[model samples]
Target chain A: MAYSDKVLDHYNNPRNVGSLDKADQNVGTGIVGAPECGDVMKLQIKVNDATGIIDEAKFKTFGCGSAIASSSLATEWLKGKTVDEAMAIKNTDIVNELSLPPVKIHCSVLAEDAIKAAINDYKAKGSTRKPAAGVEA
Target chain B: MRYYEALGLEPRLALDAGDLQKRFYDRSRQWHPDRFSTRPAAEQRTALEMTALINDAFRTLRDPAARAEYVLSENGLEASAQRGKDVPADLLEEVLELNMALEEADGAQVARSLGQFESMLAGVDGQLAGLFAAWDAAPSAGRLEPVRAALNRRKYIANLVRDARKTLETARET
Candidate 1:
């Protein structure tokens, strides 16, 4: 039942806790929930279109300390990473960094899912804005 | 299923409370340790085990939510096995928005949201009643799926209501 120091630290002072404009073409928002625990997490990333790097990340989570910490850490790792690099981020990395216990492993998975969902949303928006010019024509 | 077996009832979702109480008491008396005290040590052990199982069965089967969960687990649809993949996106969005509003809600706003959440809980419970009957009439995976989804939604809303009440109490105390 005891949380690791890292989890407590992030929990008490979660970084990048806020929201991004979902309507912005460059911003991707991911909202996910855990029915088992009644937890909801929202993670958003603003990608720098010119460089394809994530310049901003934010999260709002309503759940246990572990879930809040997981999403907080996720946003921190998300910023400054290119889209491809962000996609490679895994839940295990968050688990190791946060020292989450076995029961809290699902929190990390939720964070990873949020990251992927946000990226997918951003990519989906991009594909819609610009059609496949050469292939269709 | 074992709980149902322990109480000598079929594994069904709906049960009369009075009948269940009677069955529990009847089984408890039959397995009372006093009756087995004069018997062999093996018989005494069996009595002790039966007493525990009967108590557990009564406790679980009395609550509709817990009873549904028991049936789900027996059929390989355990709640813990669910990862929110089945949660509709619109529900998640609504939950997120409500949480955001709650963070900044004043006393009046909190009370309003509490009323809304309570009614939502009522709606979910009503849905559950219909689902339980549907499953009892004809048990099938298709029928159980909606029951599980409704249970998940109920759990989420229940948590919201609990937290909102706590927040309101704290606000009043301060």
Candidate 2:
């Protein structure tokens, strides 16, 4: 089946396609593998330490184009937001936004999951403030 | 039943594969269905069935684990299925507790727990393997299906844990 227009948009003009300084304590990085498909995704977020907001988000994905599009959309949704707000983001929304079919729905979910992993990595390392709102410093 | 019964000798399990292949080719020249395709219908059918039997026997003898399982099963020493169904209560408890933890966690928190869940999964895999071996050693067939069903449940639940982890990891992005 043909991809939805939104997925095509994200694929054609991917947002947040680069890396951030991984050494920053406030930044959490998530790298995940899809063993069944032998796919890999690297997602990163820079959270404001004091505010728990996401200042910048980026991704590097090595997989199908659907996966790449999903990551791009996810990064757009996450940037300039509080970590808590980002956490509230849903895979269903991504699917709806992309109008992904059942076969490619997993790609949207994968993107959502990559975001959560990055945030969780930050939380586990001990930043007490709940994820804040509006990522801009 | 004769190994050389091709020529009248016993088929040796330890025959080198290359030698076995050569011998099989030699026999096929005389007994192959390709040679009898234009012959009587009865002869063709017999040739087909014998060829199938020979190939089945060859494959069965080739794999060590399949051979062992076949031998034990034929001798009525197969592992009892019921032995695996009795999963320890503590393992069940652990599974339940982890499920509860994931249920209570938000997306970000659940992502944080994924690594731990992965390690837990490894342990579960080990337990399942041990149970399989133990059952194989038992003589009962009565509980085998139920035991396999329980193992399937564990596998299904493990997939859910993985799903939860994935949700936690990437929910924030979109």
Candidate 3:
């Protein structure tokens, strides 16, 4: 199948293609996979605690060109957005930007799911950590 | 179910390959187009269709993975319908780690890991066998759930193995 030029562009030069430290308290990691196609994607976001904004985003995906491009575009959109804004990002947005075909829509859905999972992970970590009571200046 | 009916067998996960082959051959002979050429046109068409179905059924049921997939589809658990929601967290982590390793590994490192990936594939196949037996012994939704999960894992590992092999081949050519 012919891939949209945008999809090929992101696939050839995927932005923010790397990893963030999963153990970091401020970093949220999302790992997801599509069983039907054996596609696996890992997207991570490092949120600025003080600004409540995502300062960095990284992703690694192993699948078809569409899957790679979806996650790559997702990371690009993720940076500079607050956690709330990131939550608003939808699969349809990715589909529209990438011009993904009907069959490849699931690739965009996977990216959306990764974003949610990462944010949830970040929130879970924040809630689990003890509050700084005595150390307050 | 048509595949099972074509082969004169019940819709079950586990099957005796030799018996299946025997049934296929017996049915193929019974419906062979050559034997129906003198019959009516409709009868000839039926013979041709039956032969085609038998051939397809044999090809699909002879392979363990294909057979399991057929059973799953028959039970309304299509592989393509599965999304990230059903994938276990640990399995995704392991697959991600393996992909990361493959990305960073040199030619020699990749070649070395090919063996590991093949062994992993074999291990998944063994797991599939056990799952198939479980479903055959006691047919239930619960029994088929693990079978689907195992098939997914098997597919992931198989893709990894294929990629690793392709990388090695490309290195050799270069």
Candidate 4:
């Protein structure tokens, strides 16, 4: 099947392809998979603690070109944005942007999952570590 | 949905491969997304995707070892990927020998190895069947982890054997 131009473009030149310092307080990492497609994706975000802003994002994915594109686009949307703003990124917007075929909709779902995973990771880790309390030794 | 529900089968341990194959073909002809290509574009697209899912599930369940692995996974257990490092020494030694022979075997030797491996696979499958029956009867969480690990081990070894057979077939064909 022919991939949409956007999918092909992202697949050819993927963006935000790397890993975050998972140790960082504001970092969120998401991992999701669909057994039907045998696809898995990991999305990570580094957020600025004081500002609650996303400073950077990265992702790793194992799947077809459409999955790659959706993730690439997600990270592109995530970077340089506040955590709240990033959370607002919608799967339907991605589906529209990529013009994903109905059969390929799962790719969009994976991307949305990555976004949520990254946010949850950041939240889980960020709230605990940020404002590091002085050790009353 | 339950696996049995997905396959439109009653939950049962033993199944007839020949009879199941006939049912599978009939289902494929009737409900496979490919048959809906001439329908609406949206419906066709849905059909195409569902067809792929059906095919994937069917292929996995049709094979004894793959089915075992999936059953293991359903219980939230996985065999170790670094099994060579993490597995018991005795198991490691056996796997190593099997792998080395598979790696070095000529096409004819590999074909012979495949027959031997099939018998071994059958043994593993029988063990898996017993394990599954036990799990179904008792449904013990305590047993699942270890059982899953063993099943995973079988799956990995089973996959390697299939890979070896494929390589041998390629060599013989060429």
DockQ of each: 0.69, 0.02, 0.80, 0.02
Clashing residue pairs, backbone N/CA/C < 3 A, model 4: A28-A122
TM-score of each: 0.95, 0.44, 0.93, 0.54
- Pick the winner on lDDT between candidates 1 and 2: 1
lDDT of 3 by residue, B78-152 (tens): 887887979999999998888789878899899888989999999999998898888888899999999999999
Per-residue lDDT over B37-69 for candidate 4, one digit per residue giving the tens place of the 0 to 100 score = 689989888767666666776786777656655
Restricting to chain A, the TM-score for each candidate equals 0.93, 0.86, 0.94, 0.91
- Please write out the lDDT profile of model 1 over residues B30-73, one tens digit for every residue: 99999999999999999999999999999999998899999999
Error of 1 at B53 (Å): 1.5
Residues A1-137, model 2: lDDT tens digits: 79878878877888888777767778787665442232446689998766567889988775567888888989988988998898998989888888888877667767777888888877776654444455542
Lowest summed lDDT window (length 10), candidate 4 chain A: A31-40
**Highest-lDDT candidate:** 3
Candidate 1 accuracy as lDDT? 0.92
Candidate 4, overall lDDT?
0.70
* lDDT assessment of candidate 2: 0.64
* Candidate ranking (DockQ, best to worst): 3, 1, 4, 2
Residue B11 in model 3: lDDT: 84
Error of 3 at A127 (Å): 1.9
